[model samples]
Target: MLTIWSGLAVGAIYVLVAIGFNIMFVASDTFNFAQPQYLMLGTFVSYTIVVSLGLPLVVALVVGGVVGFAVGVLEDWIAIRPLSGTGVHGELVTTVGWSVIMQGCVLLLWGSAPHRVPGAGSDSVLTLLGGRLSVNDVVLIALAVGLSFGTHYWFTHSKLGIAGLAASEDRQAAMIRGINVNRLSTGACAVAGALLGSLGAVVGPKTFAVFTLGSILVLKAFVALAVGGFGSFKGALIGGFAVGVVEALVGRYLGTEFANLAVFGVLIGVLLLRPQGLFGQRRERVV
Candidate 1:
């Protein structure tokens, strides 16, 4: 039970990284492999503000979000926008390069040591439904679940969100209908970046403010995205929680060495059984 609880908490982080990937991928067909790096940057920025510079946690949160937004915008301008209509799929390689650059910058600036942030609340364990977990875990679970579902509703219901949906469905058609696909793409990146940045304060304590945090998250989040469906927020939520719980169970029963292998196995199984993912839709275009 405790293992399940622990997995849920860790899975929430994956949920966040998954959401970042989905949001950007929604507007830009290019997946920002660097999205997790932005999350890693957020934790370190939060740590620097709170620990090194001795600022308020709130300040760290705000600054991290702003920095993330700037980084996203920069990535779009330098790496994505120029190659937009070239039909070159170069963004794929560029985004991966950007991630390497981000990781390198973090190493140069912060070194490789893992730094702990003060938890948002007391870390004391609480028993609920026969599971011992911390208050922070409960908060994280609520946040991840609520955000994923709420984003789904927003995409289905809200005007701007619907516009984003239109853009995602058919960028050229959306442009014909007066939707600004470029702005939409930039907005997607910025919003995704902001989410990654602001959550750093919350996530840092659990994952630690570490250089390799992005590496830790990127692959698992991609797995969660694939498991849930590439573009579905609801799938992101379900897949993330499933991955976390499964990883925890495997780690406990089999051994830590088998945990990653188990996750990869799950990915393979899902791809074989449902290539479109759990919530993914199959599309056919009329020529």
Candidate 2:
């Protein structure tokens, strides 16, 4: 049970990261390899506000989100917009370069050491279903579930969200229909950055602020995205939780070293069985 709770907390973070990836991919039809850096920067920003500046958690989150949003917009303008209409490989290389630059900046500013921040919730523990869990864990679980469901509903029902989806499905058609593709793309990046920033504050206590954190997170999040099916919001949530739970179980029973092996083994197996992923739809060739 403790393992389950811990896995859920980690899964929540993965879900947020995956969602950010999905948002960016849908809006721009390109993956932002630098997305994980936003998460890293958000954590450091929150630490600066809440720990160094001695501000309230809410303030830290808000500031972090704003900074993240600005960075996201900057990325779209500098890295994405200029490379638009180019092949995916170019964008991928550009984004990866940007991610490396951000990592360097973080190392220079924050140094090589990891910094810890206060938890989002109290240290108190509660028992549920014979499992003892911390308040922070509960909060993480709640936020993960809530945000996942909320995003799904918003995409399905909200006008702007639906427009974003339409734009993603057919950017040319959306443009002909009077939708501003550029604006949508920028807005999607901003939204993704904000979500990642706020999530950093929420999960800071579990994972310390560190420069190298982004690399690990981005890899895990990508795994979740691939497993859940790219572009499927619900799949991100499901894939994240599945990865987290499986990793936790493997680490507990087998060994820490075997955990990653098992996770990737599962991914390989899944890909072999269903290349499109669990919820991902395979695109059919019109030809």
Top model by lDDT, which number? 1
True lDDT of residue 60, candidate 2: 77
Per-residue lDDT tens digits for candidate 2, residues 43-75, read 898888889999999997888789889988888
Please report the TM-score between candidate 2 and the true structure: 0.96
Displacement of the residue 30 alpha carbon in candidate 2, Å: 1.8
Which has the greatest TM-score? 1
Reference-based TM-score of each model: 0.96, 0.96
| Residue-level error in angstroms, candidate 2, position 280 | 1.1
* Residue range 122-224, candidate 1, lDDT tens digits: 3777899899988778878888998898888877888888888888777788889998878888888888888898888888878889999998899999999
lDDT of every predicted structure (CA atoms):
0.87, 0.84
Q: In candidate 1, which residue pairs clash?
A: none
Q: Report the Cα lDDT for residue 62, model 2.
A: 89
Instruction: List clash counts for every candidate, in order.
Output: 0, 0
Instruction: Quote the positional error of residue 188 for candidate 1 in Å.
Output: 0.7
